[model samples]
Target: MAFTGIPFAALDFYEDLEADNSKVWWNAHKDVYDRSVKAPMAALAAVLEPEFGQAKLFRPYRDVRFSKDKTPYKAHQGAFVARGPSLGYYVQIDPAGLFVAGGFYGATTEGIARFREAVDTEVRGTELEGIVAAMQEAGFDIGGDQLKTKPRGYEADHPRIDLLRHKTLTVSRHFGSPPWLETPDAAVQVRDAWRNMAPLVEWAEQVLQ
Candidate 1:
């Protein structure tokens, strides 16, 4: 399907789902979820596939076996284009708005060790810091899994100690119900953010793998 934009009903669907997360509610509103939410999400991912690769849509069912909250449905829908086993670019939609990001969601102990090693070096470390700065300048918020204290060997005095604290590095931003979200320009917005964050994703792919 050609990309148009996310419909307003998509937002409404999520808004109601947040209140009643039961199967009864879902069955009654199943058509809205399929037509308004899932279709646009698929369309949005489709247009970006040429440059970003195919996106995998997350199943709406929540995995409650390991979680405390037993909510049956997800409040948001997300799609991801992976570059490595655990690193990739992403987009999500919900009642609040659109969220776009790129980076490793999780890292193995060995992968994090390698990331710290890269951050300890002057050339690669500073290069990463520069890319992070540029991403912030372009309006994306930086976040992801992080350590509470300095890693075992890295000193508090280390110049890039902050960067070294990250176990999973990512940049994202929420664009809340913007007007463009209802038009084709929404795809362009996602493209621009993904393109801008390519360096960080590339850096993680190299260091983590």
Candidate 2:
């Protein structure tokens, strides 16, 4: 099936699941989930695969073995386009809204070191600054965890201090339940958002490579 858009029922499923997150409830409503939520997401992924590369849907089951809150199922459905081994575009649909993001969200130790090195170099560092500025100007949110203090080798007043302190770097944008979300245009919105953030994704890929 061609990708139309996410129906309102998908959001409704998440809202309902948030309240009743139990094995029994989930098993009973599994068909609703498969039809209302997963199918649309799968179709959307299919539509995106041509331009973005192979698409993979995330499992809804949470890995709670290491966590405190042991919710059996995730309240949202997410998927990503795989451009290479490290980073690609991401999409999520949940009760709250839709989110589109890209870049390296969980960089390896080597990846982080490489990224910082790129940021510290004059030419690449200036290029990165401009990319980030363009993303912000386009209204996407810069994301990732950061160190409270300066990283070990970097000076406190480093020119790229803000980018230097980041453990992971990603660009994201959120959309509330807009009218277009209920139509085929939702996929268009996500595609445009990802396109808008492509420079950052490309930069991160090069830095991490």
Candidate 3:
């Protein structure tokens, strides 16, 4: 279903948030995740009108516990909100730092190597690095202070190429938007701030892709 300015209950806001480590949560609330976050993103993609396939969502669980720094899930919720023939825009929902953007990254270790190579070799030398550097200048940190390049050990020739995960500010609350979400730039405005977030209903739809 699409968001038509309907006022959902506050419980709806926390459904996905509360879906931590429980199959029950995943089974019961996966639909909620679709509804609350992915749906609105799809709507935005429609409005922005990308020239490629529909948007899609990555899985939440990352098994990094064996590594030095372990995270239960990614801090940012995202989708391929819009796409051009060559590149795509990822509309990320970071409520703790609620914002959105378009980009690429690898979800696995081998994929991460290509991702790292791309970022270090491709992005850092191009306009994307400027955007990443700008976000850093604005106070957001990458992954964490420890892992700078990208996580390694992903499968080679993976589907997700040049995928780099982003981190929300550590200081922000677990569920609130960051202060910088209101930057005057339209893309930054929609991509970074929660007050003017694209409707969750639409985001829910995009992620289902």
* Top TM-score hit: 1
Q: Kindly list the per-residue Cα lDDT of model 2 for residues 69-170, writing each as its tens digit.
A: 998999999998865555889999999878889988787888889989999999999999999999999898998989999999999999899999998888
**TM-scores, in order shown?**
0.97, 0.96, 0.38
Model 3 lDDT tens row, 132-208: 44545655433322244444553434333233332211111122343333322333344343212222212212322
**Over the stretch 43-74, how does candidate 1's per-residue lDDT look in tens digits?**
99999999999999999999999999998999
* Candidate 1 RMSD to the correct structure: 0.9
Off by over 4 Å in 2: 84-86
Q: Candidate 3, which segments miss by more than 4 Å at Cα?
A: 1-20, 51-53, 59-76, 81-87, 94-97, 102-188, 191-209
Reference-based lDDT, residue 28, model 3: 61
What clash count does candidate 1 reach? 0
